[model samples]
Target: MKKVSKAIINFDDYVERKNTDSRKWSMAGMHEMATYVDDNSIPLWVADMDYKVPTIIIEKLKKRVEHGVFGYSIPSEEYYNSIKYWNKIRNNWEIEKEWIVSTPGVVVGLNFAIKAFTAIGDGIIIQNPVYPPFKSSILNNNRVIVDNSLIDKNGLYFIDFEDLEKKASNPKNKLMIICNPHNPIGKVWTKEDLEKIGEICFRNNVILISDEIHSDLILFGNKFTTIGILNENIINNSIICTSPSKTFNIAGIPVSNIIISNEKLRMEYLNEIIKSGLKPIPSLFGAIAVESCYTLDGLEWLEEVKRNLENNYIYLKDYLKENIPKITCGHLEGTYLAWLDFKKLGYSNQVLNEKLEKEAKLVIDPGEIFGEMGTGFIRLNFACHKKILIETLERLKIVFGK
Candidate 1:
């Protein structure tokens, strides 16, 4: 494990989103901002990080920008090969070249998968306290939502295999979406968990769509079990939607590769992606970001990010347990997000929002937005500089008014 260079990447070299109509920072202020209200809370609510994309990626993007033609660009083998090669090397999962399909983003691929396997009224099973988009994709596709909520023990969340088996075995359910190293709660599913889910879904004739967007972001001692490696049964039953977005902070580039080994399913998914025609630029920017993160400087930087997140998690855990003891939170094995339990505070979602807004002055994703299960659990993003994180915690401490 080599060290990632800590040299300060100049802020001036980075693109500032304050005025560019970016959804991340700008979404906080926009009148039509669907999720957040117009207020001044340092915008850490979204999944993107404040860290600069790897310098190699930046250089490649800059060189591509200079070309100026802006015509439709098609990437070479380097683009696709990097994805296949990276997954094979890092995950120990072998993906054939023909199995991979390019897409605008993982969420898009989810929609495509829904189209591929499910009818409009079919049911989709999702692990609750998950990435919110999973529900959106299911519902937006007019599919029924069958939530298999995770069991949170203290601050750790675990899958309830019995409950999962019961729900997945229901005949109405046609698809199961697994979030590897799930967002918000951040539990990296064990091989056993994956196998159990595979068995249940298969028994019920459910097609598995594993959203592995957070697969590469696990912490020390936690190995990601790519759904592809779970079993011959699950591999044949699943499609993996992955990308450089969360890991490399190039989400705006919005490129994801859907790797499906099942021949019939792969073709069906690709056909849907083409029919929807979502805007996938040559995304020279995304391609550059992927190559850089996959081949060169990313693994080390990821280690640094992992270390930083672990440190922050420890700091928050110690401080909150000692100081703001009333508020509870839970397992953070992957993703930059933390789900804090505010149920003990006894505030309704509306009142919690008001108190957090007026008192904490910290902008976090509201618990209610995640679903009934996420009620009273606020999601925090710890991907910023350490100093900013400390300040945010301090503000929250004051919100406790202790």
Candidate 2:
């Protein structure tokens, strides 16, 4: 493997991604954006970052690629150890090798959990204004959706425990998926918050599937608490989905670790995967990348990325406050995605999206796709060069500024 660089890299340095089959850039990759704006428009949609992967991870994958042949692969002991080490050091969560199950992605793991734990016509509870897939996973599987919408006041978002309790108490509701350091809104649920959720799930016998994919990308001073760690009952009944793809910007390479402590639950979920004819091994490059990302060097690179993200967020937030006071952005506790409320401007979801694409010449995730509660909001991906973020703000100014 090539030696990794030790020098601090500039986060504002631009890397061209056009014509690289980038979903955030290419016309084919961003067909939705292409429909609204010209090909030259800037895209702030999608959850993946614009930055390159860590040098250590790239070097490791390069070494693997240098080997002549690509064939079927299985995860080595190192892969499992890397995950174990990462969880132990970063999240302070310890686990045995048997508890970890490999999946192509966290979303796939979520689907498997839904299939394993619930039947057709059963109800699945979810917090709205969540990652869109949470709704689709339930609906596509022919399960009923019990939405416990999060309450948004001013700019802060809170889980409506009373609504949640009511939804979970429905005997038909068999599962609930939790997004920690939540996407779009960026609320990192506290220990008390997670425990309340766990207690509700326990009381109603609703299986909990916590998506902690963004746990490592937490910003500000917020801490991420895994739902499985809240109690023994929660642990036994929970399926915690985690991945290095989001944190390391390797979403193209499929890899996720679904942790289920209970043996019976693990077997049932594993069986669902097998029945679907999916193998346990992830892509070879993904395995190498994941293992490399758990090292000390990798963590150092992550710390720098977090610092850059924090700086970018502050700049964007402050710019909006000073220049576009009508636009309300919530406190970004975690994740590179910023949820901006445009309700004050009084445009419907369609008009807001059109204005952003045509008027601003910028593409962003329309908030309505997250849920009906997300209307009049937009989710902007800020994991880019600071200059890019500055340009995005300028574009918004053209659309909404006086």
- Best candidate per lDDT, number? 2
Residue 202 C-alpha lDDT in model 1: 75
Alpha-carbon lDDT of model 1: 0.77
lDDT by residue (tens digit), candidate 2, 39-128: 758878888898887777777788888996988888888888888888988888898889989898999999999999999999998888
Q: lDDT of each prediction vs. the true structure?
A: 0.77, 0.86
Q: Which regions of candidate 1 deviate over 4 angstroms? A: 1-17, 29-39, 278-282
What are the TM-scores, per candidate, against the unseen true structure? Answer: 0.91, 0.96
The Cα error of candidate 1 at residue 328, in Å, is: 2.0
Best by TM-score: 2
Residue 81, model 2, lDDT: 88
RMSD of each: 3.2, 1.9
Weakest 10 consecutive residues, lDDT, candidate 2? 1-10
